[model samples]
Target: MSDPNDWDFFVGLGLALSSNLFIGSSFIIKKKALLTLQQYGVRAGAGGHGYLRQWLWWAGLITMGVGESANFVAYAFAPAAVVTPLGALSIVITAILSSKYLNERLNILGKIGCILCILGSTVILLHVPKSEEVENFEDFIIKIQNFGFISYVFILIILNIYIAFYYGPAHGKDNLIVYIILCSTIGSLTVMSCKGLGLALKDTIYRKKILTTMILQVSTTLTTSVS
Candidate 1:
């Protein structure tokens, strides 16, 4: 008989792949809807909220929400190491779809980049760690509370604050690195907190501790991500 845990892992892997499909398609859908709206009103880039009136825009948002929900749930069944890397697949999907639907050119370099992303994701999936250092909610709590991890989180927070308030305002429009750094710092925190929230939700479902530990973990995860 197959190990039940193995089954859960496969389910997580499937969900992760499906989530990428939804999310990637959402980008194209939203862009197309925005373009449609621009034909009738001011472009979004020029300060227009007309896309809000389009049903396609709302559908894209719903699709994105579904994808994100699947991704979060996948984290509960698989290690963050596995689920996080799969996010690259979304870029591959977006590139392919954009070429077909949005008339975006997928030149030689773009095609090579997508191939590299798929190869990287395949390598990661084939060699996923068999053991998790933090397997349960209790272990997760201990991991996050470690001094080294806390220090790293604090450093990221400080950098994000400094960049957003100081450096970004001055040179963000001219230098793409400003936003890249900002997103990287915040994205790291968001990924960890999202995994924590997934674990918390799983614990609540299986152990029926929704009122106590789940609530606390959920609040902590939200606070951490927002900060």
Candidate 2:
């Protein structure tokens, strides 16, 4: 079922990595921009009208959507076997952008941390076998080849339990923009974590193919606020 026009392994991996990394960083970038816009007095309560008046959130979301959608298209043209591994570039992109654009600090330890993140993710994703990948799961259970994946899944379940039970009550409520921005980072972490689970499980395919067919799923949800 392979296409003659399909991208070679290296090219496809590069594109997928580029896509995931860019899309992931753009999440936090928009979060930061939203936080900034609130400082300029955009009320989330005003919804669409409030957001349009601010402009920064609008611009940030637009830019991020384009970057995100492009990856879906790119990955659609390639196999997920070659795509998911490359998406590990998210940690790299996030670290660099946080430092250079967000003024988050480029200290020695931070640099080392980012390098380690990129290096570790790269090794796991690249060396991991596509054949060993789960590809997709049926029902609520994932047929896993690794106990490491089982442990991670358990941990995620616990984390989700805690978030669902405690996070909101503990945080004591915040400004709408600040909360959404914070939640955006949280959402990215949740997604990257899920992707990490997939990687840990060596998943190679998506039932929905967000990197392909559902490119607009998340970012588009953000955009529909205006449309």
Candidate 3:
């Protein structure tokens, strides 16, 4: 584990979490898209451009699958602690890709946020925490409480009502867009976490190659010694 050569931990953590990061992002975008369609009065039991939607969904799933596979491989080679924080680079990834493909503009504020996120993630990874086998529901509840869950829930309910009213008589695509984004964020997080858990529980291989490499790296040596 101390060796620069042993990159297994980092690789594993990175692979799994990166998959999560991408999956989460894709879901977020996809959700927004579906919401637009909903605004078009196409909810459940409807088929118009349904073929296009299906195609888009499948494409997203395929991309997600490739991401997940790479994540699994990373997990096999590195530690989750090492890999997850690298996911902080996701915003950067999105910004660049979006700029190139979608012609989205990334302002200075966004650039700063992306940098900070990456910095924070790198800090977290340097610490190299051991992966917890299970989430502590108690801790989860406490954290939610600290974040003012009651207030959040209240606001969410209010938003739902507003959306309902706003979209009435004639549905507005905006509401659907917002709703889809919310759903996607939740769904992607859930699915990716589940996949990561499933892989973490299985027998692992390909770790030696990583560990060996890590040990040889001077930074890792210094980093481990100081830690």
Q: Each candidate: RMSD to true structure?
A: 2.6, 9.3, 13.7
Candidate 1: global Cα-lDDT? 0.84
lDDT of 2 by residue, 1-227 (tens): 86334333344455566676657677666767666767667556656345555556666677667656544444334444445445556767877777677777777987787788678766766565434233233211344325775676576566656654777456636535544544444454344334333332223353433332232243344333321
lDDT of 3 by residue, 1-227 (tens): 37543444555665766676676566545544555566765654465555255555566666767775665456434544555456556557767666665557878999899889778876876775555432332333344345565575567566666655664325655357766645444443333333333343333232221223221243233323422
Query: For each candidate, what TM-score against the reference?
Result: 0.86, 0.45, 0.43
lDDT of each: 0.84, 0.52, 0.52
Judged by lDDT, which candidate is best? 1
Model 1 regions lying over 4 Å from their true place: 165-175, 211-227
Error of 2 at 177 (Å): 27
By lDDT, the better pick of 1 and 3 is 1
> What global local distance difference test value does model 3 have?
0.52
Better-scoring candidate (TM-score), 1 or 2: 1
What number of backbone clashes does candidate 2 have, counting pairs of residues 3 or more apart or in separate chains? 2
Q: Residue 65 in model 1: shift from native, Å?
A: 1.0
